[model samples]
Target: MPLPNILRYLHREQRFLAVFVVGAALVAGFVKLAGEMQEGDTQALDIAILKALRLPEDPSQLIGPSWLHSAATDLTALGGVTVLTLVSILAVAFLLLLGRFRQALFTAIATGGGAMLSTFLKGLFARPRPEVVPHLVEVTSMSFPSGHSLNSAIIYLTIAVMISRSFEDRKSRIFTITVAALLVLAIGCTRVILGVHFPSDVLGGWTLGAAWALGVGLLAATLQRKHKIEEPDGSIADQSSGPAPDQIGS
Candidate 1:
């Protein structure tokens, strides 16, 4: 199958460039946003958004239909510890079954590292959860950066990038990334709507999460380039024409 010319070119010539530009941008954004949050610059915006989700007379009561609240709760769960853990385990198991041990290790490191990073940031910030509106869901963690939003982006986006490398078709790669992005966006929104996090919290999470995920991907790509880790099926190997005949490449 013919890949999009630009996408293929990017994979071959600009992998490092792409990761650097995107990762740097995300890190910069996260820093700027965190500073604003610390200075209380985001207070007005956060309050406005939180209020918008609730009824005018009673901030404790959500504005949406009953079903929406339930749906948001379900979606938010997708980013929770239990759900994400199961996903990581299943993915790693599948990779191992295919004998892609190195890829499996990379997946474990990316997901585990992201979780640790989230916990550390939460402790460092120790920002309180929103009080303007009654929380639709119970939460006890620090709230500057929503853990659900951050972890969801890190896990889903990293998995998407890894899986996309196995496909030679540009459309397939784009679709995978797009889907991951949408899921991250939806989960972040749900946290805000549930009144468990502030807008700036979600923003901070996404910014840092994107940076972390892309950074891991860059490392994996570097290892693949050096033949230190196994490349996914159809990935360019030393710019070879294709995998060795009957090699069943990882």
Candidate 2:
């Protein structure tokens, strides 16, 4: 088949089509956001949002009760290295046990690639963390793209998409994807609320992270179409009909 026809067929799938549109928007938005941040155009907005969580009397302290602080801290940890790593490992292990080695590898690559990309972008911008309010958590890195926010989005969304693809029902796929999106958003919001990241930093992280996941997903879909990567029932298909011969469809 022609490349265009293949793409058209892929686009006809509602999920992949929605992801492509969202992914393109995110990439473009990330570029524009990075440019504006570089020029220091977002200082006022950042400060305003950062300070919104603080009391009027003491700018250094957060306005919420003590429990809220603890809650934010706990929620933000969901995006931390330890938590994300554990989730990824468990997911990869489950897939491996299911004999879905290709899917497992792709999941690892998408997450690992997102982390590397986030680090590179942070260094490229070399933006500092917010000093307008006292940070609730320790951080030691350039802060244009929030590592937590980026990695959380990358890890959760990538895993969600992978798992959702295994299901044969539309509602199940949508539910899983929606939950992942909410978790990603909550994690990003906690970073900003805790005064560790500016709103723009979180925004940039989300944009790039989501785009990266979707890009990887589309690649996997393409491979699946070409029979290089197997579908959800590939294992059963293999058992019943021997291994599928690798071939590109016309």
Alpha-carbon TM-score of each model against the true structure = 0.87, 0.87
In order, candidate lDDTs are: 0.85, 0.83
In model 2, where do residues sit more than 4 Å from their true spots?
A: 1-18, 236-250
Candidate 1's displacement at residue 142, Å, is 0.3
Clashes (candidate 2) = 0
lDDT of 2 by residue, 22-97 (tens): 9999999999998998888988999999988998788767887878888888999999989999999998898888
